[model samples]
Target: MNVKSGSAFFLKVIAILIGIAVLAVCIYWLPAAARRDAIERPGDYSLYPLLVCAYGVCITFSVVLYQVFKLLTNIEKNNAFSELSLHSLKLIKKCAFAVIFFILLAIVYLKVLTQFTGDDPAGPISLGLMGILATSVVAAFMDVLQKPLKNVLDEQLKND
Candidate 1:
């Protein structure tokens, strides 16, 4: 394979490794953390919603990773400037938005629970806001990339 394709392949491998790591954390670490919380708080903690939020975020992560893999494949095929790459970027952006949505929903749920349980929601809310900020940046980057790609595609059409 060529250098560019080799790099793309390396990146794809990295993405797959990241997916596996995230999956391990979600399947093992998250449940273990939940169990710890349960043991500490007994019946007072709301475990299900927390798990739902975590799993929801994990779903988004998988989607984004898949999209990244698609994008890398396009690059490997030397079609990084094609519509498929643009579409993959768009899908990644959507996944980022989904992450933000899930985090926000979790924050709202935790806020409601905190009111009755007397638990401080500041930490989680801050984390959610950070997630929102990160996703917003990703979406903006996708939007920026789309603009240039659209222009190039339009130019290509005009040339033809």
Candidate 2:
């Protein structure tokens, strides 16, 4: 597909919207659930670590989103589809790194929870972490596919 086409732009916009929704869920629902569970269980601050993990993921996702948007802006400024495709691939690479980091962080949090002796109340966080990991995997594949597209664009641009 043409990276500079309207469809690509539309997909990017959709991704941004999904990111926003995830952020909103993290900010509102995640905290309230953690707080409630903490209060109900009293003496079990286990949720704290999970909450922290969620926040960390949220922060990283925000950064990823910011970087992606910046990349999009830069791509839009380029005259050739090849240049834009390359920028998008780079952004996806960064996003994959961020996702992997967050997944590792989540795993660490889960391990810590298991060691501390308490309820595994961070189900939402764990689930969200998995979602991010899956997303990153897909994004990484896209970046890989973009390599050939970038080459094609480069050749086309050279001819022009």
Candidate 3:
């Protein structure tokens, strides 16, 4: 296979693997962590808030991954420089923002709850911060890419 198509193939594989990994985390890790939280707090909190946060995260990240897949498809079709790919990048950035929003909301929720429970919020807060940072970086990357793509499209329009 050619270098371009080969790269797209590899990226597709990577994206699928990432989806699987996230599914596993949602199925396994989240439940275990929730159980631990319940055991530690006994009756201080319900899992519903955490579940909502997880649901938001999963939804947004899934959109990001779907956008990545669409972007790769555009690359394979030689349309990576076109409006469709730009739209995909825009959507991915939006998804990143959604993820950040959810993380911040969850952090705030945890902070308020911990204040009442007298529990240390450090652990979850730190984790949420890291998630926020990561999501912000993804949004920034999409912003940078979209700008170049817009510039290219503008230049092409002028030439045409």
Candidate 4:
């Protein structure tokens, strides 16, 4: 295979691995954390629902990665300038926005909980803010990328 195809394949593999890792975290690590909380703390299940929400966000993130894989497949098939690629990018951007929204909601919830219970929410709130920043950057980057890609697609259509 040529370098381009090789790189596309590599990216596909990486996306799949990331999906698997996120799945494991959602399925195993999240539950374990909840179980540890229940066992060790006994009465504090306040963060349990937030953990579930985080898992939901992670599942959405995996869907975004799958969209990326589809986009890469289109590129490998020389269909990068097609509507399918545009759709994939749009879905990825939407997913990134969804993640940011969820993180923002989590931050708000944590802030309220801290206000009520006087528990220090610094670490989790900071992490949620970081998540918001990262996903916002991704959404902005995707918007920038979409403009040039849309131009390319339009140009290709005119040429055809």
Task: Write one digit per residue (lDDT tens) for candidate 2, span 104-142.
Answer: 776777767766766563774677667876877867686
TM-score of each: 0.88, 0.62, 0.88, 0.92
Q: Is candidate 2 or candidate 3 better by TM-score?
A: 3
Question: TM-score of the candidate numbered 4?
Answer: 0.92
Q: What is candidate 1's TM-score against the reference?
A: 0.88
lDDT of 3 at 26: 83
Which residue pairs collide in model 4, if any? none
Best by lDDT: 3
Q: By how many angstroms RMSD does model 3 differ from the true structure?
A: 2.2
lDDT of 4 by residue, 3-53 (tens): 999999999999999999998998899889898889988998788768867
- Lowest-lDDT window of 10 residues in candidate 4? 47-56
Question: Model 2, stretches more than 4 Å misplaced?
Answer: 1-13, 64-85, 118-133, 149-160
How accurate locally, in lDDT, is each candidate?
0.89, 0.71, 0.90, 0.89
What lDDT does candidate 4 reach at residue 47?
Answer: 81
Give me the overall lDDT of model 2.
0.71
lDDT of 1 by residue, 37-120 (tens): 988988966878878989999988998999999988888877988989888888888888888888988999999998988999
Scanning candidate 1 in windows of ten residues, the lowest lDDT window is 44-53
RMSD of each: 1.9, 4.8, 2.2, 1.5
How would the candidate models be sorted by lDDT, starting from the highest?
Answer: 3, 4, 1, 2
Off by over 4 Å in 4: 158-160
Residue 98, model 2: lDDT of 65
